[model samples]
Target: MKDMSENERVARAMMATGRYFTATELREQLGLTVEKAAATLGAIRRCKRYITQVIGSPRHYKVKVLKVLPSPTWHCGEVAPPELTDRQRQQIHYLSSVVFKPSRGIA
Candidate 1:
C-alpha cells in the first residue's frame, strides 16, 4: 500500500472525530502555515463526499466528519463524511448552538 499523503492523514483524523475545527486549528494541528492551511482545507473540501458545506466567517469555519464505517480492506485515501444518525444530528445541533453562544461578561 502507498503511504498516506499529509492531507489524507489530516483528513482521516478529522473524519474520525465528529467536531468542528477552524483553519487556524488545522494549521496548528498540522504544523502548517496560514497559506498552507487554507490550501489544505480547499483540498479536503474537494474530496469530502458528505459534510461538504463549510459554514462560518471567512477566517473561521465549523467542520466535522460524519462517522462512517471503514471499508473491508485497509483503504486509506481521501476523507468523506458518512450518513449521520439521528443522534449525531442532534449532537451537531446542540454543539453548534453552544459553539455559537456569545460570552456574557463585563464589557
Candidate 2:
C-alpha cells in the first residue's frame, strides 16, 4: 500500500533534519498549501498499515516505517520502480481535485 500524500513525502524528507515538525516548518520547507499539509495528515491518519495504525490522537502521522515488509530485491538485475496503488492514486487525485473533461470543440 502507498503512504500518504506528496506532502507526507516532503515531511519524511524534512524529518531527516531531526527536527520536530511544526505547522510552520511544514509550510516553509515543503512550500505546500496549508490544506495540503492537513490533507496529507488526513491520508496518514487513514492509513491501515501496521506501521501507522497505532499512534496517539493527532498522531504525528510520521512517515516512519516500523515493520518493513520483505520483498524479492534481486530480480536478475531488475530495478522495479515503486508505484502508488490504484486506490491510493485515486485518493490523491481526489485530493488534487483535477478535473477531467472532454475537449470542447466540434468533432
Candidate that would win on lDDT: 1
What TM-score goes with each of the models? Answer: 0.50, 0.36
Question: lDDT tens digits, residues 1-107, model 1?
Answer: 65756666777778766566677888777688978877777776656433445678765676665543333334454345579999999999887788766668868
Full-model lDDT for every candidate: 0.66, 0.52
lDDT of 2 by residue, 1-107 (tens): 43343644654564456544444446677887777765655554455422333333464433333332233344453457688899999887876675654457979
Off by over 4 Å in 2: 1-8, 49-107
Supply every candidate's count of residue pairs whose N, Cα or C atoms clash at under 3 angstroms: 0, 0
True-vs-predicted CA distance for residue 61, candidate 1, Å: 2.9
What C-alpha lDDT, on a 0 to 100 scale, does residue 55 get in candidate 2? 39
Which stretches of model 1 miss by more than 4 angstroms?
48-53, 57-60, 67-107
Give the lDDT of residue 54 in candidate 2.
Answer: 31
